[model samples]
Target chain A: SQTIHQWPATLVQPVGSPLSLECTVEGTSNPNLYWYRQAAGRGLQLLFYSVGIGQISSEVPQNLSASRPQDRQFILSSKKLLLSDSGFYLCAWSTTLNYGYTFGSGTRLTVV
Target chain B: AQTVTQSQPEMSVQEAETVTLSCTYDTSENNYYLFWYKQPPSRQMILVIRQEAYKQQNATENRFSVNFQKAAKSFSLKISDSQLGDTAMYFCAFLGDSNYQLIWGAGTKLIIKP
Candidate 1:
């Protein structure tokens, strides 16, 4: 059985603080990992996706960046967070596009 | 640019009744895929159904089914015997064969009342 773990669950930080959200998968190898953000009443926005370790493709240009330190570990980071960066962040993994993605529980970050 | 549209922002129905949610998309590419996802209070994105453009038959999963009209570029989800558990936000997504990412609609909030 495959499972994804994403943490802090929820966090509140001041603007200009550094941010790091981690996501890791268990029971799967070389799966495609993706980072997405959702704002209230808005659709999910794709931030970054990784095909392999250290191979990242970004969909949106912003203060956010992604890294795949391990085959199953994907990280989203921002050196200096902005107030507008506050939102619900989700991590998803997929073996192929024909099948739907398996998403993590998500992390809610409130930048005050 | 490709786009997905969910015309109905919200819908409400009683228990055991049937409800249909509408979705439409625009794409010049001939081969693509359509998906319907449910976001419950837990906020997990659950894939309810998926329709492949090459297939003419519609997709179904138990009480949930899709009415896919490729010519009209319309894909609608029909929920039968609706339950209170069905109350959540539903989103439609489009994935083109040549594109790596998905284009999602704003989303439709569905409320199943008792």
Candidate 2:
């Protein structure tokens, strides 16, 4: 079975601190990766999506960026975090021909 | 641009009752996909049901089913014998074939009383 692994299930970081959240998928190759954030009791906001390595399309222009250095490894980073950057971050992957998405457990980050 | 609208922000129903959540979407493309996802207190998204645009027959899985009206661009989810575990945030999403990225609506919070 295919599985996704995300690190640091929860984090509390101070404002202006650097951030790095990692996500990796196993049992799949060349999967379409995506990063999404959801506000408290709200809907999902698309941040970034990668169709292939070195190719990333950002949906929202904000304090974060995504990098797809490897086929199955995707990393989300921020140089300086803001109080508004706090939310639940999710990682998802899908096959090229398949429209169905498989999402990770998600990371709950709180900026204090 | 494609968009999804979930009119009901919150709804409540007694256990074992049947409830229908409403969803409507706007798109210019003919081929697309509609999905209903469930998020519990744990906040993990679970695919509840999906409707493909090219199909006329509605999709059903166990006690969950969808009323898909392509002409009206409306897709509503009906849960039979609703259980307390059905208490969660339900999100309606649209994915056009041109753009596979999903367009999400402000989720509806469904609370099932025991």
In terms of TM-score, the best-performing candidate is: 2
> Candidate 1's residue-wise lDDT over B2-68, tens digit each?
9999999999999999999999999998999999999998888888999999999999999999999
Off by over 4 Å in 1: none
Provide C-alpha RMSD values for all models, in order: 1.1, 0.9
When candidate 2 is compared with the true two-chain complex, its DockQ is 0.61
Q: Give the TM-score of each candidate.
A: 0.97, 0.98
Over the stretch B1-114, how does candidate 2's per-residue lDDT look in tens digits? 898999999999999999999999999999999999999999988889988999999999999999999999999999999999999999999988878598898999999999
Per-residue lDDT of A11-111 in model 2, one digit per residue for the tens?
99999999999999999999999999999999999999999998999999999999999999999999999999999999999885335688899999999
lDDT of 1 by residue, A53-77 (tens): 9999998899999999999999999
| Backbone clash pairs in model 1 (N, Cα, C under 3 Å; residues 3+ apart or in different chains), count | 0
**Residue B112, candidate 2: alpha-carbon lDDT:** 99
Among all windows of 10 consecutive residues in model 1 chain A, the one with the lowest summed lDDT is: A94-103
Q: Which residue pairs overlap in candidate 1's backbone?
A: none
Docking class of 1: medium
